[model samples]
Target: MLSFNIYLYCGGNISMKMAFRPTDGWRWYFDREYDSLMLEVSSDMLFRSCYPSKMLIPDVFSEFSFSVSDAASYYQFHNCCHSLNLTESQKIQLSINGIVAANFLKPQMPKSWYFSQQSTEYTPKVADIVKVYMQEDGLEVCMMVVEVGEHASLCIIAQPTFFSMNKTFYFSEAIKVMNDRLALAQQFAQPDNSIVLDDEELELKAIS
Candidate 1:
Protein backbone atom coordinates (compact mmCIF):
# COMPACT_ATOMS: atom_id res chain seq x y z
CA MET A 1 0.00 0.00 0.00
CA LEU A 2 1.27 3.48 -0.75
CA SER A 3 1.94 5.65 2.26
CA PHE A 4 2.51 9.36 2.84
CA ASN A 5 3.89 11.38 5.77
CA ILE A 6 1.29 13.95 6.81
CA TYR A 7 2.45 17.15 8.44
CA LEU A 8 0.22 19.34 10.63
CA TYR A 9 0.93 22.66 12.28
CA CYS A 10 0.33 22.92 16.01
CA GLY A 11 1.22 25.91 18.15
CA GLY A 12 3.18 27.43 15.31
CA ASN A 13 5.26 24.23 14.97
CA ILE A 14 5.11 21.47 12.39
CA SER A 15 4.94 17.76 13.19
CA MET A 16 4.85 14.75 10.91
CA LYS A 17 2.62 11.75 11.30
CA MET A 18 1.66 8.73 9.22
CA ALA A 19 -1.82 8.63 7.79
CA PHE A 20 -4.03 5.62 8.40
CA ARG A 21 -3.85 2.91 5.71
CA PRO A 22 -6.96 0.90 5.12
CA THR A 23 -7.36 -2.20 2.96
CA ASP A 24 -8.51 0.15 0.16
CA GLY A 25 -9.10 3.84 -0.54
CA TRP A 26 -7.00 7.03 -0.72
CA ARG A 27 -4.24 8.30 1.51
CA TRP A 28 -4.82 11.60 3.29
CA TYR A 29 -2.18 14.14 4.27
CA PHE A 30 -2.40 17.48 6.03
CA ASP A 31 0.02 20.02 4.60
CA ARG A 32 -0.69 22.95 6.91
CA GLU A 33 1.43 25.46 5.03
CA TYR A 34 -0.91 25.20 2.07
CA ASP A 35 -3.82 25.40 4.51
CA SER A 36 -5.30 22.33 2.86
CA LEU A 37 -5.31 18.58 3.39
CA MET A 38 -4.38 16.44 0.39
CA LEU A 39 -6.09 13.22 -0.69
CA GLU A 40 -4.35 10.87 -3.13
CA VAL A 41 -6.49 8.26 -4.82
CA SER A 42 -4.85 5.46 -6.77
CA SER A 43 -5.10 5.24 -10.55
CA ASP A 44 -6.35 1.68 -10.35
CA MET A 45 -9.20 2.75 -8.12
CA LEU A 46 -10.07 5.61 -10.47
CA PHE A 47 -10.05 3.21 -13.42
CA ARG A 48 -12.85 1.24 -11.78
CA SER A 49 -15.15 4.00 -12.96
CA CYS A 50 -16.28 3.33 -16.52
CA TYR A 51 -15.92 5.89 -19.28
CA PRO A 52 -18.25 8.91 -19.02
CA SER A 53 -18.30 8.62 -15.27
CA LYS A 54 -19.13 11.63 -13.14
CA MET A 55 -16.00 10.87 -11.16
CA LEU A 56 -14.01 13.19 -13.38
CA ILE A 57 -11.07 14.76 -11.62
CA PRO A 58 -10.17 18.32 -12.44
CA ASP A 59 -7.11 19.06 -14.57
CA VAL A 60 -5.66 20.64 -11.46
CA PHE A 61 -5.68 17.19 -9.87
CA SER A 62 -3.97 15.54 -12.82
CA GLU A 63 -1.84 13.60 -10.36
CA PHE A 64 -4.97 12.13 -8.70
CA SER A 65 -4.45 14.53 -5.82
CA PHE A 66 -7.43 16.36 -4.33
CA SER A 67 -7.58 18.64 -1.32
CA VAL A 68 -10.02 20.30 1.12
CA SER A 69 -9.03 23.36 3.05
CA ASP A 70 -8.66 23.22 6.88
CA ALA A 71 -9.97 20.79 9.48
CA ALA A 72 -13.46 22.26 9.60
CA SER A 73 -13.72 21.95 5.85
CA TYR A 74 -12.63 18.35 6.02
CA TYR A 75 -15.08 17.64 8.80
CA GLN A 76 -17.92 19.24 6.88
CA PHE A 77 -16.91 17.27 3.78
CA HIS A 78 -16.76 13.95 5.62
CA ASN A 79 -20.08 14.60 7.28
CA CYS A 80 -21.66 15.46 3.97
CA CYS A 81 -20.61 12.05 2.65
CA HIS A 82 -22.71 10.36 5.35
CA SER A 83 -19.66 8.09 5.68
CA LEU A 84 -19.31 8.36 9.40
CA ASN A 85 -20.90 4.94 9.65
CA LEU A 86 -19.36 3.53 6.48
CA THR A 87 -16.14 1.58 6.15
CA GLU A 88 -12.98 3.19 4.85
CA SER A 89 -13.31 1.66 1.41
CA GLN A 90 -16.98 2.63 1.24
CA LYS A 91 -16.10 6.20 2.08
CA ILE A 92 -13.58 6.23 -0.79
CA GLN A 93 -16.18 4.98 -3.22
CA LEU A 94 -18.64 7.58 -2.01
CA SER A 95 -16.11 10.33 -2.58
CA ILE A 96 -15.15 9.03 -6.02
CA ASN A 97 -18.73 8.78 -7.19
CA GLY A 98 -19.89 12.00 -5.57
CA ILE A 99 -17.38 14.52 -6.85
CA VAL A 100 -19.92 17.32 -7.21
CA ALA A 101 -21.25 16.83 -3.72
CA ALA A 102 -17.71 16.76 -2.34
CA ASN A 103 -17.18 20.31 -3.57
CA PHE A 104 -19.54 21.57 -0.86
CA LEU A 105 -17.23 20.17 1.82
CA LYS A 106 -14.89 23.08 1.23
CA PRO A 107 -15.47 26.11 3.43
CA GLN A 108 -17.24 28.90 1.56
CA MET A 109 -15.25 31.46 3.48
CA PRO A 110 -12.38 31.41 5.94
CA LYS A 111 -12.37 29.99 9.47
CA SER A 112 -13.36 33.43 10.65
CA TRP A 113 -16.59 32.86 8.82
CA TYR A 114 -17.52 30.36 11.48
CA PHE A 115 -16.31 32.62 14.26
CA SER A 116 -18.38 35.47 12.90
CA GLN A 117 -21.45 33.28 12.89
CA GLN A 118 -21.36 33.25 16.65
CA SER A 119 -21.74 37.01 16.57
CA THR A 120 -24.63 38.50 14.64
CA GLU A 121 -22.74 41.71 14.07
CA TYR A 122 -20.11 40.07 11.91
CA THR A 123 -22.40 37.91 9.83
CA PRO A 124 -22.19 38.77 6.15
CA LYS A 125 -25.35 39.72 4.26
CA VAL A 126 -26.43 38.96 0.75
CA ALA A 127 -24.94 41.29 -1.87
CA ASP A 128 -22.12 42.29 0.44
CA ILE A 129 -19.02 42.80 -1.66
CA VAL A 130 -15.52 41.96 -0.51
CA LYS A 131 -12.12 42.16 -2.16
CA VAL A 132 -9.88 39.11 -2.38
CA TYR A 133 -6.15 39.25 -2.98
CA MET A 134 -4.72 36.12 -4.57
CA GLN A 135 -1.22 35.89 -3.17
CA GLU A 136 -0.13 33.17 -5.59
CA ASP A 137 -0.65 35.44 -8.61
CA GLY A 138 -0.95 38.87 -6.94
CA LEU A 139 -4.39 39.36 -8.49
CA GLU A 140 -7.43 40.79 -6.74
CA VAL A 141 -10.83 39.15 -7.12
CA CYS A 142 -14.11 40.64 -6.04
CA MET A 143 -16.58 38.42 -4.20
CA MET A 144 -20.31 39.06 -3.72
CA VAL A 145 -21.22 37.60 -0.38
CA VAL A 146 -24.34 35.60 0.42
CA GLU A 147 -25.15 34.24 3.84
CA VAL A 148 -25.26 30.45 3.89
CA GLY A 149 -26.39 30.17 7.49
CA GLU A 150 -25.47 31.32 10.94
CA HIS A 151 -22.07 29.69 10.49
CA ALA A 152 -21.05 30.30 6.87
CA SER A 153 -21.37 32.56 3.82
CA LEU A 154 -21.11 31.94 0.09
CA CYS A 155 -18.64 34.22 -1.70
CA ILE A 156 -19.47 34.41 -5.35
CA ILE A 157 -16.71 35.83 -7.52
CA ALA A 158 -17.69 38.43 -10.08
CA GLN A 159 -16.74 36.97 -13.45
CA PRO A 160 -18.44 35.79 -16.60
CA THR A 161 -17.59 32.14 -16.00
CA PHE A 162 -17.89 32.33 -12.22
CA PHE A 163 -20.62 29.74 -11.97
CA SER A 164 -18.80 27.05 -13.95
CA MET A 165 -15.24 27.75 -12.82
CA ASN A 166 -13.42 26.53 -9.75
CA LYS A 167 -11.90 29.53 -8.04
CA THR A 168 -10.19 29.70 -4.66
CA PHE A 169 -8.81 32.41 -2.44
CA TYR A 170 -6.48 32.36 0.53
CA PHE A 171 -8.18 32.09 3.92
CA SER A 172 -5.86 34.70 5.42
CA GLU A 173 -6.78 37.24 2.77
CA ALA A 174 -10.48 36.53 3.31
CA ILE A 175 -10.05 37.16 7.01
CA LYS A 176 -8.42 40.48 6.21
CA VAL A 177 -11.45 41.51 4.17
CA MET A 178 -13.76 40.46 6.97
CA ASN A 179 -11.71 42.47 9.42
CA ASP A 180 -11.79 45.54 7.23
CA ARG A 181 -15.55 45.31 6.91
CA LEU A 182 -16.00 44.77 10.62
CA ALA A 183 -13.82 47.77 11.40
CA LEU A 184 -15.85 49.87 9.04
CA ALA A 185 -19.09 48.63 10.53
CA GLN A 186 -17.87 49.42 14.04
CA GLN A 187 -16.66 52.88 13.13
CA PHE A 188 -19.82 53.86 11.33
CA ALA A 189 -22.19 52.21 13.85
CA GLN A 190 -24.57 51.63 10.96
CA PRO A 191 -25.33 48.85 8.52
CA ASP A 192 -22.41 49.50 6.17
CA ASN A 193 -23.59 49.58 2.56
CA SER A 194 -20.24 49.15 0.85
CA ILE A 195 -20.97 46.55 -1.84
CA VAL A 196 -19.37 48.00 -4.90
CA LEU A 197 -16.08 46.77 -6.37
CA ASP A 198 -13.74 49.63 -7.09
CA ASP A 199 -13.46 50.36 -10.82
CA GLU A 200 -9.76 51.04 -10.30
CA GLU A 201 -9.26 47.54 -8.85
CA LEU A 202 -7.62 45.05 -11.17
CA GLU A 203 -9.69 42.12 -12.39
CA LEU A 204 -8.68 38.55 -11.65
CA LYS A 205 -7.26 36.55 -14.52
CA ALA A 206 -8.03 32.94 -15.33
CA ILE A 207 -5.36 30.43 -14.41
CA SER A 208 -3.58 29.00 -17.44
Candidate 2:
Protein backbone atom coordinates (compact mmCIF):
# COMPACT_ATOMS: atom_id res chain seq x y z
CA MET A 1 0.00 0.00 0.00
CA LEU A 2 1.19 3.49 -0.89
CA SER A 3 1.36 6.15 1.86
CA PHE A 4 2.59 9.74 1.88
CA ASN A 5 2.70 12.89 4.04
CA ILE A 6 1.35 16.36 3.30
CA TYR A 7 2.96 19.02 5.47
CA LEU A 8 1.61 22.56 5.70
CA TYR A 9 4.45 25.01 6.17
CA CYS A 10 4.57 27.02 9.39
CA GLY A 11 6.33 30.35 9.05
CA GLY A 12 9.08 31.79 11.34
CA ASN A 13 8.97 29.10 14.08
CA ILE A 14 5.82 30.35 15.83
CA SER A 15 4.47 27.58 18.05
CA MET A 16 2.01 26.78 20.82
CA LYS A 17 3.28 27.24 24.37
CA MET A 18 3.53 24.02 26.35
CA ALA A 19 4.55 23.22 29.88
CA PHE A 20 8.33 22.78 30.05
CA ARG A 21 9.36 19.72 32.02
CA PRO A 22 12.98 19.05 33.06
CA THR A 23 12.97 15.73 31.14
CA ASP A 24 11.80 17.39 27.90
CA GLY A 25 15.34 18.69 27.22
CA TRP A 26 16.02 15.93 24.66
CA ARG A 27 13.09 16.97 22.41
CA TRP A 28 12.15 13.38 21.56
CA TYR A 29 9.72 12.81 18.67
CA PHE A 30 8.22 10.04 16.51
CA ASP A 31 9.55 9.36 13.04
CA ARG A 32 6.76 8.12 10.74
CA GLU A 33 9.15 7.29 7.93
CA TYR A 34 10.90 4.60 9.94
CA ASP A 35 7.89 3.62 12.10
CA SER A 36 10.16 4.40 15.06
CA LEU A 37 10.65 6.85 17.91
CA MET A 38 13.44 9.32 17.17
CA LEU A 39 15.79 11.53 19.17
CA GLU A 40 15.58 15.12 17.95
CA VAL A 41 19.20 16.01 18.77
CA SER A 42 20.75 13.09 16.85
CA SER A 43 17.91 11.49 14.81
CA ASP A 44 18.64 8.13 16.45
CA MET A 45 15.56 5.91 16.29
CA LEU A 46 14.17 2.76 17.96
CA PHE A 47 11.63 0.44 16.40
CA ARG A 48 8.60 0.25 18.67
CA SER A 49 6.41 -2.65 17.53
CA CYS A 50 9.26 -4.77 16.21
CA TYR A 51 12.48 -5.28 18.15
CA PRO A 52 15.71 -5.33 16.09
CA SER A 53 14.09 -4.10 12.87
CA LYS A 54 16.18 -5.06 9.84
CA MET A 55 16.56 -1.38 8.83
CA LEU A 56 17.11 0.21 12.29
CA ILE A 57 19.21 -2.65 13.69
CA PRO A 58 21.78 -3.90 11.23
CA ASP A 59 22.23 -7.41 9.76
CA VAL A 60 25.78 -7.18 11.12
CA PHE A 61 25.48 -10.49 12.97
CA SER A 62 24.50 -12.52 9.90
CA GLU A 63 23.73 -12.22 6.19
CA PHE A 64 19.93 -12.62 6.45
CA SER A 65 18.16 -9.47 5.23
CA PHE A 66 14.52 -8.33 5.42
CA SER A 67 13.34 -4.74 6.11
CA VAL A 68 10.02 -3.01 6.65
CA SER A 69 9.48 -0.36 3.98
CA ASP A 70 6.81 2.31 4.69
CA ALA A 71 4.41 3.85 7.18
CA ALA A 72 1.23 2.19 5.89
CA SER A 73 2.66 -1.35 5.99
CA TYR A 74 4.26 -0.75 9.37
CA TYR A 75 0.98 0.56 10.77
CA GLN A 76 -0.91 -2.40 9.33
CA PHE A 77 1.43 -4.85 11.05
CA HIS A 78 1.20 -2.96 14.36
CA ASN A 79 -2.58 -2.73 14.13
CA CYS A 80 -3.23 -6.33 13.10
CA CYS A 81 -0.91 -7.71 15.76
CA HIS A 82 -1.85 -5.09 18.40
CA SER A 83 1.83 -4.93 19.35
CA LEU A 84 1.88 -1.29 20.48
CA ASN A 85 -0.02 0.39 23.28
CA LEU A 86 -1.47 3.57 21.84
CA THR A 87 -3.10 6.36 23.79
CA GLU A 88 -6.15 8.41 22.70
CA SER A 89 -3.97 11.13 21.14
CA GLN A 90 -1.77 8.53 19.52
CA LYS A 91 -4.77 6.77 18.01
CA ILE A 92 -6.06 10.06 16.68
CA GLN A 93 -2.64 11.07 15.34
CA LEU A 94 -2.21 7.66 13.73
CA SER A 95 -5.61 8.05 12.10
CA ILE A 96 -4.54 11.41 10.69
CA ASN A 97 -0.84 10.90 9.92
CA GLY A 98 -1.21 7.19 9.00
CA ILE A 99 1.89 6.25 11.04
CA VAL A 100 3.33 8.88 13.42
CA ALA A 101 2.60 8.41 17.11
CA ALA A 102 1.64 11.48 19.15
CA ASN A 103 4.69 11.24 21.39
CA PHE A 104 7.22 8.88 22.95
CA LEU A 105 6.28 5.90 25.11
CA LYS A 106 6.99 7.54 28.48
CA PRO A 107 8.32 4.39 30.19
CA GLN A 108 10.56 3.56 27.21
CA MET A 109 12.33 6.91 26.87
CA PRO A 110 16.06 7.24 26.21
CA LYS A 111 16.94 6.24 29.76
CA SER A 112 14.83 3.07 29.65
CA TRP A 113 15.37 -0.08 27.62
CA TYR A 114 13.88 0.42 24.14
CA PHE A 115 13.81 -3.16 22.83
CA SER A 116 13.55 -5.80 25.56
CA GLN A 117 12.18 -5.05 29.03
CA GLN A 118 12.08 -8.73 30.04
CA SER A 119 15.77 -9.11 29.24
CA THR A 120 16.61 -6.55 31.95
CA GLU A 121 16.94 -9.27 34.60
CA TYR A 122 20.59 -10.35 34.56
CA THR A 123 21.58 -13.49 32.68
CA PRO A 124 24.71 -14.46 30.77
CA LYS A 125 22.75 -14.45 27.50
CA VAL A 126 21.34 -10.97 28.19
CA ALA A 127 24.83 -9.68 29.08
CA ASP A 128 26.13 -10.94 25.74
CA ILE A 129 23.23 -9.25 23.87
CA VAL A 130 23.97 -5.95 25.63
CA LYS A 131 27.62 -5.99 24.62
CA VAL A 132 26.71 -6.93 21.04
CA TYR A 133 23.91 -4.35 20.72
CA MET A 134 26.22 -1.55 21.86
CA GLN A 135 28.69 -2.49 19.12
CA GLU A 136 25.94 -2.99 16.54
CA ASP A 137 24.43 0.43 17.37
CA GLY A 138 27.73 1.98 16.27
CA LEU A 139 28.82 5.66 16.45
CA GLU A 140 25.54 7.33 15.49
CA VAL A 141 23.14 6.24 18.26
CA CYS A 142 25.25 4.35 20.79
CA MET A 143 28.19 6.79 20.95
CA MET A 144 25.92 9.79 21.61
CA VAL A 145 24.10 7.89 24.37
CA VAL A 146 27.41 6.82 25.97
CA GLU A 147 29.05 10.27 25.86
CA VAL A 148 26.06 11.77 27.71
CA GLY A 149 26.46 9.14 30.52
CA GLU A 150 23.03 7.59 30.05
CA HIS A 151 22.35 3.87 30.21
CA ALA A 152 19.52 3.08 27.78
CA SER A 153 19.04 -0.37 29.18
CA LEU A 154 19.89 -2.25 32.37
CA CYS A 155 21.90 -4.65 30.25
CA ILE A 156 24.24 -2.03 28.79
CA ILE A 157 25.61 0.40 31.34
CA ALA A 158 28.29 1.45 28.84
CA GLN A 159 31.22 0.07 26.90
CA PRO A 160 34.74 -0.05 28.34
CA THR A 161 37.25 2.36 26.79
CA PHE A 162 41.05 2.38 26.51
CA PHE A 163 41.61 5.79 28.18
CA SER A 164 40.83 6.66 31.76
CA MET A 165 37.90 9.09 31.95
CA ASN A 166 38.83 12.13 34.06
CA LYS A 167 36.01 14.12 35.65
CA THR A 168 38.02 16.24 38.12
CA PHE A 169 38.47 19.22 35.80
CA TYR A 170 36.16 22.23 36.26
CA PHE A 171 33.53 22.58 33.47
CA SER A 172 34.00 26.32 33.11
CA GLU A 173 37.78 26.03 32.85
CA ALA A 174 37.42 23.33 30.22
CA ILE A 175 35.05 25.49 28.19
CA LYS A 176 37.44 28.45 28.40
CA VAL A 177 40.39 26.33 27.25
CA MET A 178 38.33 24.85 24.37
CA ASN A 179 37.26 28.34 23.22
CA ASP A 180 40.90 29.58 23.33
CA ARG A 181 42.08 26.60 21.28
CA LEU A 182 39.20 27.06 18.78
CA ALA A 183 40.19 30.71 18.29
CA LEU A 184 43.86 29.70 17.76
CA ALA A 185 42.83 27.10 15.15
CA GLN A 186 40.67 29.70 13.33
CA GLN A 187 43.59 32.18 13.44
CA PHE A 188 45.92 29.72 11.71
CA ALA A 189 43.24 28.48 9.26
CA GLN A 190 43.05 31.92 7.59
CA PRO A 191 46.36 32.81 5.86
CA ASP A 192 45.61 36.58 6.06
CA ASN A 193 44.97 36.34 9.83
CA SER A 194 47.74 33.76 10.54
CA ILE A 195 50.91 34.83 12.36
CA VAL A 196 54.21 33.61 10.87
CA LEU A 197 57.31 33.43 13.08
CA ASP A 198 60.83 32.04 12.55
CA ASP A 199 61.95 29.05 14.64
CA GLU A 200 64.45 31.22 16.69
CA GLU A 201 61.87 34.04 17.05
CA LEU A 202 59.20 31.57 18.18
CA GLU A 203 61.65 29.99 20.66
CA LEU A 204 62.60 33.47 22.02
CA LYS A 205 58.90 34.44 22.34
CA ALA A 206 58.18 31.10 24.09
CA ILE A 207 61.13 31.70 26.48
CA SER A 208 59.95 35.29 27.15
Candidate 3:
Protein backbone atom coordinates (compact mmCIF):
# COMPACT_ATOMS: atom_id res chain seq x y z
CA MET A 1 0.00 0.00 0.00
CA LEU A 2 1.11 3.54 -0.69
CA SER A 3 1.21 6.15 2.10
CA PHE A 4 1.67 9.92 1.92
CA ASN A 5 1.01 13.19 3.77
CA ILE A 6 -1.05 16.13 2.50
CA TYR A 7 -0.60 19.72 3.69
CA LEU A 8 -3.05 22.55 3.20
CA TYR A 9 -2.42 26.24 3.75
CA CYS A 10 -4.60 29.20 4.55
CA GLY A 11 -3.28 32.76 4.30
CA GLY A 12 0.21 31.31 3.90
CA ASN A 13 -0.12 29.26 7.13
CA ILE A 14 -0.67 25.54 7.32
CA SER A 15 -4.36 24.94 7.92
CA MET A 16 -4.70 21.18 7.72
CA LYS A 17 -2.80 17.92 7.31
CA MET A 18 -4.11 14.83 5.58
CA ALA A 19 -2.77 11.30 5.56
CA PHE A 20 -3.41 9.08 2.56
CA ARG A 21 -2.85 5.36 2.37
CA PRO A 22 -3.65 3.22 -0.61
CA THR A 23 -5.44 0.81 1.70
CA ASP A 24 -7.38 3.54 3.57
CA GLY A 25 -7.74 6.29 0.93
CA TRP A 26 -7.40 9.69 2.76
CA ARG A 27 -7.50 10.45 6.50
CA TRP A 28 -7.15 13.60 8.58
CA TYR A 29 -3.67 14.18 10.02
CA PHE A 30 -2.35 16.89 12.34
CA ASP A 31 1.40 16.39 12.31
CA ARG A 32 3.67 19.28 11.35
CA GLU A 33 6.44 19.25 8.69
CA TYR A 34 6.53 15.55 7.95
CA ASP A 35 8.06 13.76 4.97
CA SER A 36 6.92 14.45 1.46
CA LEU A 37 3.73 12.85 0.12
CA MET A 38 5.11 10.39 -2.43
CA LEU A 39 4.71 6.65 -2.77
CA GLU A 40 5.44 3.90 -5.29
CA VAL A 41 2.55 2.56 -7.28
CA SER A 42 4.26 0.57 -10.01
CA SER A 43 7.81 1.68 -10.84
CA ASP A 44 7.68 5.21 -9.38
CA MET A 45 5.53 8.02 -7.95
CA LEU A 46 5.08 11.55 -9.26
CA PHE A 47 4.15 14.88 -7.58
CA ARG A 48 2.77 18.11 -8.98
CA SER A 49 0.51 21.01 -8.02
CA CYS A 50 -2.02 23.03 -9.98
CA TYR A 51 -5.05 25.15 -9.20
CA PRO A 52 -5.92 23.16 -6.07
CA SER A 53 -9.55 24.23 -6.05
CA LYS A 54 -10.09 22.49 -9.36
CA MET A 55 -10.14 19.13 -7.63
CA LEU A 56 -12.64 18.96 -4.77
CA ILE A 57 -11.33 16.41 -2.26
CA PRO A 58 -14.03 16.75 0.38
CA ASP A 59 -16.74 15.68 -2.02
CA VAL A 60 -14.79 12.66 -3.23
CA PHE A 61 -13.90 11.44 0.22
CA SER A 62 -16.54 11.31 2.98
CA GLU A 63 -13.97 11.61 5.77
CA PHE A 64 -13.86 15.39 5.40
CA SER A 65 -16.78 17.78 5.38
CA PHE A 66 -16.95 20.78 3.06
CA SER A 67 -16.45 24.14 4.72
CA VAL A 68 -15.66 27.59 3.39
CA SER A 69 -12.75 28.29 5.71
CA ASP A 70 -10.96 25.07 4.78
CA ALA A 71 -12.02 24.77 1.19
CA ALA A 72 -8.54 25.17 -0.21
CA SER A 73 -7.35 22.52 2.22
CA TYR A 74 -9.71 20.05 0.66
CA TYR A 75 -8.24 20.80 -2.74
CA GLN A 76 -4.78 20.27 -1.35
CA PHE A 77 -5.75 16.73 -0.38
CA HIS A 78 -7.05 16.18 -3.88
CA ASN A 79 -3.77 17.44 -5.29
CA CYS A 80 -1.91 14.99 -3.08
CA CYS A 81 -3.90 12.14 -4.55
CA HIS A 82 -3.02 13.25 -8.04
CA SER A 83 0.62 13.48 -7.04
CA LEU A 84 0.53 10.00 -5.52
CA ASN A 85 -0.88 8.44 -8.72
CA LEU A 86 -3.86 6.75 -7.11
CA THR A 87 -5.16 3.57 -8.71
CA GLU A 88 -8.67 3.05 -10.08
CA SER A 89 -9.57 0.83 -7.13
CA GLN A 90 -8.34 3.43 -4.66
CA LYS A 91 -10.41 6.13 -6.33
CA ILE A 92 -13.51 3.92 -6.34
CA GLN A 93 -13.01 3.14 -2.65
CA LEU A 94 -12.68 6.81 -1.85
CA SER A 95 -16.06 7.32 -3.46
CA ILE A 96 -17.68 5.73 -0.41
CA ASN A 97 -21.11 6.00 -1.99
CA GLY A 98 -19.97 3.94 -4.94
CA ILE A 99 -19.29 5.19 -8.47
CA VAL A 100 -22.30 6.03 -10.57
CA ALA A 101 -20.38 5.68 -13.83
CA ALA A 102 -16.79 5.58 -15.17
CA ASN A 103 -17.05 5.48 -18.91
CA PHE A 104 -14.05 6.14 -21.15
CA LEU A 105 -13.34 6.21 -24.86
CA LYS A 106 -10.32 4.43 -26.25
CA PRO A 107 -7.74 6.67 -27.85
CA GLN A 108 -6.45 5.41 -31.12
CA MET A 109 -2.74 5.07 -31.79
CA PRO A 110 -1.05 5.99 -35.03
CA LYS A 111 0.43 3.29 -37.23
CA SER A 112 4.22 2.95 -37.41
CA TRP A 113 5.88 3.14 -40.82
CA TYR A 114 8.59 0.65 -39.97
CA PHE A 115 6.32 -2.39 -39.82
CA SER A 116 2.99 -3.48 -41.17
CA GLN A 117 1.49 -3.63 -37.75
CA GLN A 118 -2.11 -2.59 -37.13
CA SER A 119 -2.31 -0.10 -34.31
CA THR A 120 -3.97 -2.42 -31.85
CA GLU A 121 -2.82 -0.39 -28.85
CA TYR A 122 -5.35 2.01 -27.46
CA THR A 123 -5.57 3.94 -24.19
CA PRO A 124 -8.85 4.35 -22.36
CA LYS A 125 -9.53 8.04 -21.93
CA VAL A 126 -12.04 8.86 -19.26
CA ALA A 127 -15.23 10.46 -20.53
CA ASP A 128 -15.99 14.13 -20.02
CA ILE A 129 -18.16 13.37 -16.99
CA VAL A 130 -17.44 10.93 -14.16
CA LYS A 131 -19.83 10.95 -11.25
CA VAL A 132 -20.01 9.46 -7.76
CA TYR A 133 -22.61 9.88 -5.05
CA MET A 134 -22.85 9.31 -1.31
CA GLN A 135 -25.43 10.00 1.41
CA GLU A 136 -24.33 10.89 4.93
CA ASP A 137 -25.82 12.62 7.95
CA GLY A 138 -28.93 13.91 6.16
CA LEU A 139 -26.92 15.18 3.23
CA GLU A 140 -25.97 13.85 -0.16
CA VAL A 141 -22.56 14.44 -1.76
CA CYS A 142 -22.15 14.31 -5.49
CA MET A 143 -18.70 14.32 -7.04
CA MET A 144 -18.26 14.71 -10.75
CA VAL A 145 -15.31 14.90 -13.12
CA VAL A 146 -15.30 16.55 -16.53
CA GLU A 147 -12.39 15.57 -18.69
CA VAL A 148 -11.16 17.35 -21.80
CA GLY A 149 -8.77 15.24 -23.80
CA GLU A 150 -6.08 14.33 -21.28
CA HIS A 151 -7.15 16.93 -18.74
CA ALA A 152 -9.67 16.36 -15.96
CA SER A 153 -11.86 18.78 -14.03
CA LEU A 154 -13.62 18.02 -10.72
CA CYS A 155 -16.69 19.27 -8.88
CA ILE A 156 -18.43 18.48 -5.59
CA ILE A 157 -21.96 19.35 -4.60
CA ALA A 158 -23.42 18.70 -1.16
CA GLN A 159 -27.17 18.99 -0.66
CA PRO A 160 -29.28 18.78 2.45
CA THR A 161 -32.19 16.34 2.40
CA PHE A 162 -33.99 14.14 4.88
CA PHE A 163 -35.54 10.70 4.63
CA SER A 164 -38.81 12.13 5.91
CA MET A 165 -38.95 14.57 3.01
CA ASN A 166 -38.38 11.90 0.40
CA LYS A 167 -42.09 11.73 -0.35
CA THR A 168 -42.31 15.49 -0.80
CA PHE A 169 -39.20 16.06 -2.91
CA TYR A 170 -39.33 14.59 -6.38
CA PHE A 171 -36.33 12.62 -7.65
CA SER A 172 -36.18 14.97 -10.65
CA GLU A 173 -35.87 17.92 -8.26
CA ALA A 174 -32.81 16.38 -6.66
CA ILE A 175 -31.23 15.72 -10.04
CA LYS A 176 -31.89 19.27 -11.17
CA VAL A 177 -30.28 20.62 -8.04
CA MET A 178 -27.26 18.40 -8.52
CA ASN A 179 -27.00 19.51 -12.13
CA ASP A 180 -27.16 23.16 -11.15
CA ARG A 181 -24.48 22.68 -8.54
CA LEU A 182 -22.29 20.88 -11.04
CA ALA A 183 -22.62 23.74 -13.50
CA LEU A 184 -21.65 26.22 -10.80
CA ALA A 185 -18.66 24.14 -9.78
CA GLN A 186 -17.54 23.93 -13.39
CA GLN A 187 -17.29 27.68 -13.61
CA PHE A 188 -14.48 27.67 -11.04
CA ALA A 189 -12.85 24.45 -12.15
CA GLN A 190 -9.51 24.42 -13.98
CA PRO A 191 -7.38 21.89 -15.76
CA ASP A 192 -4.74 19.89 -13.84
CA ASN A 193 -1.04 19.71 -14.68
CA SER A 194 0.61 16.43 -15.53
CA ILE A 195 3.07 15.00 -12.98
CA VAL A 196 5.61 12.42 -14.04
CA LEU A 197 7.01 9.99 -11.46
CA ASP A 198 10.67 9.14 -10.90
CA ASP A 199 11.47 5.49 -11.42
CA GLU A 200 14.34 5.55 -8.93
CA GLU A 201 12.17 6.86 -6.10
CA LEU A 202 9.49 4.33 -6.93
CA GLU A 203 11.99 1.48 -6.70
CA LEU A 204 13.22 2.69 -3.34
CA LYS A 205 9.71 2.99 -1.97
CA ALA A 206 8.77 -0.40 -3.26
CA ILE A 207 11.74 -1.99 -1.52
CA SER A 208 11.34 -0.01 1.67
Q: Write the per-residue lDDT of candidate 2 for residues 1-208, one digit (tens) a residue.
A: 1111111222233121322111223332344554543322212211122112222332122222122223333344234222223222222222222222211112233422212232233322111112212122221111101011123321111111111122111100000011111100101111121122222321111101
The number of clashing residue pairs in each candidate reads 0, 0, 0
Clash-forming residue pairs, model 2: none
The window of 10 residues in a row where model 3 has the poorest summed lDDT is 96-105
Cα RMSD, each candidate = 18.1, 22.1, 19.8
lDDT order, best first, reads 1, 3, 2
Query: What lDDT does candidate 3 reach at residue 52?
Result: 23
Candidate 3 residue lDDT tens string, 1-208:
1221121222322111334333323232211123221211112222211112222232322223223323333333234234223343232222221111111112222111111221232222222122222222222222333222232222311111113222222110112112212221212121132122233321212112
Please give the distance, in angstroms, between residue 32's alpha carbon in candidate 1 and its true position after superposition: 38
| Overall local distance difference test of candidate 1 | 0.30
**Per-candidate TM-score against the hidden true structure:** 0.22, 0.16, 0.18
Please name the candidate that would achieve the greatest lDDT relative to the true structure.
1
lDDT on C-alpha atoms for all candidate structures? 0.30, 0.21, 0.23
Pairing residues by index, what is the TM-score of model 3?
A: 0.18
Work out candidate 3's RMSD over C-alphas. 19.8
Name the lDDT value of residue 9 in candidate 1.
22
What overall lDDT, based on C-alpha atoms, would model 2 receive against the true structure?
A: 0.21
